[model samples]
Target chain A: MTTSKQSAPISFERERPAGKSAARYILGRRLSRVWLYTLLIVTGLAFGLPFFWTISSSLKSITEIYIFPPTMWPAEIRWKNYADVFTIAPFARFIWNTVIVTLLAMLGQILSAAVVAFGFTRFRFPGRESLFVLVLSTIMLPWQVTIVPQFLLFRYLGWINTYWPLIIPSYFGGGAFYIFLLRQFFLTIPKDLDEAAKLDGASNFRIFWNIVLPLSKAALATVAIFSFIGHWNEFFAPLIYLNSTDKFTISIGLRYFVSNPFESDEPREAILMAASLITALPVLILFFVAQKYFVQGIVTTGLKG
Target chain B: MAAATGRSWWHSSAQRREALEGYLWISPWVIGFLLFALGPMIASLYLSFTEYKIGGSPVWLGLENYIRAFSQDKLFWPSLNRTAYFAIATVGLGTVGSLLAAILLNQNARGRNFFRALYYLPSLTPVVALAILWQWLLQPQVGFVNYALYQMGIDGPGWLTSRQWAVPSLILISLWAGIGGGRMIIFLAGLQGVPQELYESAELDGASTLQRFFNITLPMISPVILFNVILGVIGSFSVFALAYVATDGGPNYATYFFVLHLYYNAFSYFQMGYASALAWVFFLIIFILSFVQIKFSDRWVYYEFS
Candidate 1:
C-alpha cells in the first residue's frame, strides 16, 4: 500500500511546458505547491503534537508536570512510574479483566456478526431488506439511551458484577456496525461458489463456516480489531455494570488515580499517565498490526453503518 | 386445473422452504435484536413514565418526569443548552478542519501516506489516554498551551475551570481527538468518486484550480458532506467520556453534556425515570435534526447512482 503511492509517478512531471503562458503557469504552480506543503506540515503537527505530549508527560515526574513552561522532554526519565501505577491502583487485575472481556467480546463479535452478515449478504433471505434495516436502526440509537433499561435487566439477572453483561451481548450480535462492515465484504464474494456448495449438498451453515469464513480474512480481522479496541476502551458499561472493585476493567480502574472523588489521595500524575499508557498499549499494538484492514473497513463502510 | 388451483394458507413447497431457510439463517440477529437491543429500548421507554429507583417498585406516573424536567428542574435546560452549544461549535469546526486536512492529505505529493497515518495516530490513541493528556496540556496555570501563550504576551483563560470556556475548551479537545476517521474517511470516499474528466475539462476551459475545486469537487461530494454532518451531530450530542474525564462537567456546571447529565441523574441522583425521559428527548432531538439535514440535502447532494 505504501510502496504503490510512494513509487507512483508524480502527477506534476507530465504537465511540463505548455504552448501558452508557460512561465506564468510554472510560477503559479510553484506558489500553489508551497502553500500546499505549508498547510500539510501545520496540520500534521496539530494531529501529531498531542501524541508527542502524551509520551513526554507519561515520562515526567508529577512535580515536573506542574512546573511552569512544562518540559517538552523530562530531564530524567522515571521508568519507576510504571511501578508506581500498579502500587497506586489494581493495575494488574484491571489488565487481566480487560483482556478477558476484550477477547470474549472480539470472539463473540466475529462469530455472531459474521454469521448474520453472511445470511444477509450470501443467502436469498425473506424479509432480508426489512430486517437489515432493523439491524441498521440499532446503530442510530445511542448507547446512553439504553443504559437504564440494560442496567435494570442486568440487575434482574444478577449479572451486574459479572462479565456476562459485557461479554454476552457480543455473542448475540454485538455491533450493527461490524455486521454492516462484514456484510460489505461478504457481498463481494462470488455467488457461484455458494451454488457449487449447494450442488455438493453442503448446508448454508456448513458453507458459511468452511468457505465464507476462510475467505473473509480481512473483514474478520477488521471486526476483531475494532471489537477489541471498543471493549478495551469501554468505560461506561463497565462503570455501570461491574460493582466490585476487583471486577473493574482497565478503563474504570484508571479513573482511581486522578478522578475518583471517593479516594481522597492527591492526584498522582505520574501514576495516572503510566496507567493511561498501559491501558492504551494493547489497542495501539492491535491497530498497527491490522491497520490496513481497519483503513479498508472505514473507507468502505459508513461511520458506524 | 393447475392454473385454477387455490393455494393453501401454509404452502409447503421449495419456495416456502427457501424462505424458511432465510429466516433460519437470520434468526440469531433477529433474536438478539429483540432480546438485547430492542428490549432495552422499549423498557427504557416504559420506565420513563414510571418512577423506578433501585430496590423499589416502579410507580406509574404519566409524564411526571418530563413535566419536572421542564417545569421544576433548573439544571436541565442550561445543561441541554450547553450541550447544544458544544455540539454545534465542535462539529462545525471539527468537520471543516478535518475535511480540509483530508483534502490536503489526498493530494498526490511526497510523503502523503506517512502524513495520512500520522494524522490518524491521534484517533487510534485511546480516548482515556488522550483525555488525560489534554487535561495536562490545558491545565490553566503551568500547562504548555498557556505557557506558550504567556510567552506570546497573551494570557490564556482558565480552560476547563471557567464555566464560560469549559464547553469551548472541550469542543477544541474533541475536535483534536475526533478528527481522524469520520471526515477523513468520507472525504477519501468523495475524492475517489470525483471524476478525473471534470478536472481535465475544467483545465481545458482555462479555469483555475480553486475555481475547479469549488465548481466540481464541492458539488460532487455534497452527499458525503451531508452524511458526515448528520453522523457528526448525532455523535457530538452523545459525547460523554471526554467531558466526563476532563472536567466532570466543570468548575461551574459548564461542560455537562446531555449524556453526562443523564449519567448523573440516573446513577448519582438515582433519578432513573428522569434520566430515561432525558434520553428519549435526546433521541428525538437527534432524529429531528438529522431528518431536517437529510431533507435539505436532497436539493444539493448529487448522487450519481440515482
Candidate 2:
C-alpha cells in the first residue's frame, strides 16, 4: 500500500511530455490539477451534504424547515429541539435500553467469537475444517430463513418482549461473520506462543485467554466496534421481540416518532431530524475515533479468501 | 510426515485430547448453530408445510402455503420483482460508482485522508437516520432534491410518494450513502494492491491511461470486485431498514420488497407458516444466486497473489 502511494506521484510526474513548451505545459498541468481538485471536492460535497443537511435541519424551526428556497443554515438555531426530542417520546429510555442491549451483545459476541476462532485456528481437530466451512456458509443464509422459527423459539422460551431474545444469541456465537474475522486474525498469530504457554503449564483456555487475546487487541476492537454498531442499528429483532415502548431500541423508537399518530399533526420534522442525529451520533463518533480498526477490518475481510 | 508416528493418528492420545479440547472450545458455536441456525432451519422447513399462526397449534397444510404463494398471493411475485429491481439497481450502480470513486481517490492528491473521511461519514450514520434524512431530502415539494432540481429548471418527480419513483429514489439514496462507504474503502485497498510496475511498464510501451486501467488496474483488482459484488447482492436483497422506515413498502406497494412481504405475513398477519414458506423460497433464491455468482466469478476474478 505504501509503495503504491509513493509511486503514484512519481508516475504522474513521469507522464509529462518533454517536447511541450514549458509555460504551456505548466499552464495545462495547473488547469488539470485544478480540475482534479474541483472534481474531488464536488464528489466530496455530494457525499457530505446529506450529513450537513441532517445536522442543519435538526436545528431549524418547523416553519423554517418548510420554507421554500430552503436555507442551508438555520436562520435561528434551536438547540432546544435536542431537548424537545426526549419530551416528544421516551427517547431517553430508548437510548438506555439500546445501550444495555448493545453492551451485553457486544461483550458476548466478541468473547464467544474469539473463543470459537481460537478453537479453529489453534487446534488440528477432527471435522474442524468442515465445521468452519459450515460457520462460513451461515453468513450467506438470509436471516429471514430463521427469523420466524427463532421468534417462535424465543416466544416458547418465554423470552419475548425481553432483552434476552436480543442478547442471548450473542453469547452463543455472536455471528458467523465475526467468528470468521477473528479466526482470520487468529491465524496470523504464531503457534510458538501457544507452545511456550503450554511449556509454562498453561492450559489451552489459559493460553487463549492470556496469550492469543492479548496480542489480538486490534482485531478484538474491530469485532467489538462492529458488534456495537450492528446491535445499536438492529431493528427487526427488537421490533419483533419487544412489544413494549419502554423496551424499544433507539432504531424502533425513532420509527415510532415518525409514525406515532399523536405527534403526526405537529410539524415535528426538526425534532425527528434531531432524534435521528442523536441515534446516529454514537456510531459516527466511534467511526471517527476508531476509523483505523474499521478500515483494517474491511481490508482484512476483503483481501482474505 | 515426520510428526506422523508409525501408528494410526486416531490412536494417539494427544490427538484425541486435542480433538476433545477443540470440540469443547467450539462447543458454544456448535450449540448455538444447532439451537439457532440448524434448528430454526429445520423447524421453518416443517412450519412452511403447516398452517401455524402465532398462538394456535400448527395444522398440516401440505404445500398449501407454497401453492398460495405461487398461485394466489398478489404481493408475492411483485415484491420479489421489486426486490430484484432494487438489488440490480443498487448493486450495479454501487459497484460502478464506488470503483470510480476509488480510482479517483487512489490518485496521489492532497487532502486524501480528509476527503476519504468526508465521503465515509454518511456510511457511519445509522440507517434510521439515513432514511429520515433522505425522506426530507427527497420530499417532492419542500425537499432539497426537488428544490435543487427546480433551481435548475427541472421538475423533480414525487419520490417516495410516487409509485414510479419510489424504488428508484430509495436506490439513489442508497447509492449516495454507500458509494463512498466501506465498499469504496475495499476498492481502495484493492487499488493499492495493484503493483505500480504494471502501470510503469504499460506506460513505457505507450499504453494510454484508459488502456492501462483496463489492462492492469482492473484485472489486478478483479478478486476484490468479485467480493464486493457478492456482498452487494446479499445486502441489497436483504435491504429492510430504509424501506421500512422511509416508505413502509408503500406508494401502492412499489417498494414492497421480499423481506417486507415476509415480515408482514409472519408478524402482522400472524401467518408464521406462510412466512416460513416465503423465507425458505427467499433462501433458495439467494443460495442459487450466490452459487451462480461463485460459479461465474472464475471468468473475471483474478487472484494475483494466489
Candidate 3:
C-alpha cells in the first residue's frame, strides 16, 4: 500500500495574510482541536468514574450510601468492610478455590498450546495445512454449541461438583486462539537453530523443549497471562458444574453474596462492593504489570489474520 | 532439499518419522477434539432428536423438540427476538464507538497511554462485578445516573426495573465494559497500518478531510471493522452472565437472552432435549450469519495481498 510519491509537507498552521477567511480558518482549526481534547477527556471520565465510584462506595457507611445527593467520596471511611466481607461469606475458601483452578488451568493451557503450536509450525506432514484450518475454525464455534453434551459427558463420568470440568479442558488444548498466537510466534524463529540442534544428535522433541521453548518465552508469557485472566474471571462453567457452596469459585461466590437470604432485608451493599473490588483487583494488577503482552496478544492475533 | 534426495514418498524414513512426530506432538489437541468438541457436537445433535433428562435414558422423538421450539414454546421466539435486537444494537453502536475511541487514541496527543488505560480498565473487571456496579449506577432513586438526571431537572427512567429501559440499560453496561477493550486495540492496530504518506499525498491533492477519510481510511480499516462486527455478533448473541447477575432476565423478560433461556431449560428445568434443540437452532443462525458475512466481505474488506 506504500506509495512511491514524494510530497511537500503541508502545515495547517501555514502563515496567511491578515484576512477574514484566513482568521476564520485558523480559529476553526483551533476550536476543533479544543473540541477533540474535550471529547477525549469526557470519554475518559465516563469510563473512569465507575471504577472510582465502585471503590468509594465500598468504603461508605450503610446510611451514607443511601443519603440523597450522594457524595462522591464516602463521608466516613469504613475500613472494616474489607474484613467484614470475609465474615459475611466464605470468601477465603472461595479465593482459595479460584487460585487453585486458575493455576492448574493456566499450566494446562500454556503447555498444551505450546506443544500443539510446535507441531503446526515445525512439522511438514501431509494434511497439516487442512488440520490447521480445522483448529482455526474452532475459534468461531460458540461455547453454547458444546455446553449441553459436555455437561452430560462430565456428568456421566461422575465429575460433577469437582474442579475437573473447569481444569481438564485446558489440557486438551486451552483454546484455538492461543494455539494460533503461539504458532505465529514460532514461525518467526530461525530454522538454523533447530537444524544445528538436529546435527548435534538432538531429537525433534529435544529441539522443541531446549531451544524453541526458551526462545518463545514472551509469546508463552502472553499465553499464560491471558489464560490466567480468563480462568480467574470465568463464571459460567463453574456455575454449571460445581453445585455446593464449598466448591464455588470467586465469581460464583460473589453471586452467592449478592443473593444471600440473610442479607435480603438489610443488604450489605458496602460488603458486596468490597467483595467485588477484591474479586476484580488481581486482574487490574496483572494488566498494569504486563500491559504490553495484553496489547501485543490482541493486536497480533486480530490484525495478522 | 530433503525432498530432492527422496527415492519415493512412501519409503522415505525421514518423512515417516516427521509424520509420526507430528501426530505425537498434536495428540493432546486431537484427543481433546474427540472428547470435548467433536464428540459433544455429535452427541448434542443426537440429543436434539430425543427426550433425554439428566437421570433418564434417551427416548427417540424425531423433530418433536424442534417443532415445539418453533410452534409451542412460549419463551423461544421472544427470547430469540430479544437476542437479535441486543446483537444488532451492540454490534452497531460498539463498532462505531470503539472505532472513534481508537482514532482519538491514535492522535499525537499527551497522556495517550494514560487515556487508553483509563478506558480499558473496565474491561478487566469481571462481568459479575460489572453487573453489580452497573446495577447500583442505574438505580432510579439513589443511583448516580438517575441522580445526575434529577439534578438536571429530568428524572431518569427505572433502568433495570422498567421494561422500556431494561435492555437499553444492559446495552449501556456492555458498551461501558467493552468499547475501550480488544475492539479498540484491533482498530488502533489497523489505523497504524495505514501508510502515513497516503494522507500527505491526499492533502497535496486538495482532498477534503472527509473525502480523505472516506476514500483512504475507511477502505484500509474495513477488514478490521468486518472482523469486529462478526465477533460482536457472536458475542452479543451469547449474552448471559450480565443479564443473569444484573437483571436475571426480568422486568417482564425484557432482557431474557437466548443463552439464559437455554440455560434455564437445560439446568433449572432439566429439559436437555429442548435445550439441545435450542442450541442447534442458535448455532445454525450464527453459522448462516457468519457464512453470509464471509461471502459479502469480498466486496468491502481490503487485502494488501492479492
| Alpha carbon lDDT at B286, candidate 3 | 91
Q: Cα deviation of B249 in candidate 1 (Å)?
A: 1.0
Better of 1 and 2 by DockQ: 2
For all candidates in order, the CA lDDT equals 0.76, 0.84, 0.86
**Model 3 over residues A145-205: C-alpha lDDT tens digits?**
8899999989989999999999999999779999988988898899999999989999888
- Looking at model 3, residue A169 earns an lDDT score of 95
Cα deviation at B9, candidate 2, in Å, is 1.0
Per-candidate TM equals 0.91, 0.93, 0.94
Tens-digit lDDT track of model 3 for B1-306 = 255544476368978888888888988999998888898888899999999988899999999999999999999999999999999998999999998888787665557788988988888999998898888888888988998889999989999999999999999999999899999988877776677667767767887666767788888888888889988899999999999999999988998999999999999999998899999998999999999998999898777665
Residue A206 CA displacement from its true place in model 2, Å: 1.7
Q: In lDDT terms, how accurate is model 2?
A: 0.84
Candidate 2 lDDT by residue in tens digits, A37-106? 8979999989888778878999998789999989999999999999999987999999999999999999
Runs of candidate 2 exceeding 4 Å displacement: A1-31, B1-7
Pick the DockQ winner.
2
Highest-lDDT candidate: 3
Candidate 1 lDDT by residue in tens digits, B1-306: 132332541265765676677677667788888777788788888889989898998889999989988889888898888888888987888788777777776655578767877777777666667788778778889776788799999999988888878877888888887777647766765665465667766678998857766777788777767768888898889888888888888777777778888999999988888889988888788889987987887788766655
Count backbone overlaps in model 3: 0
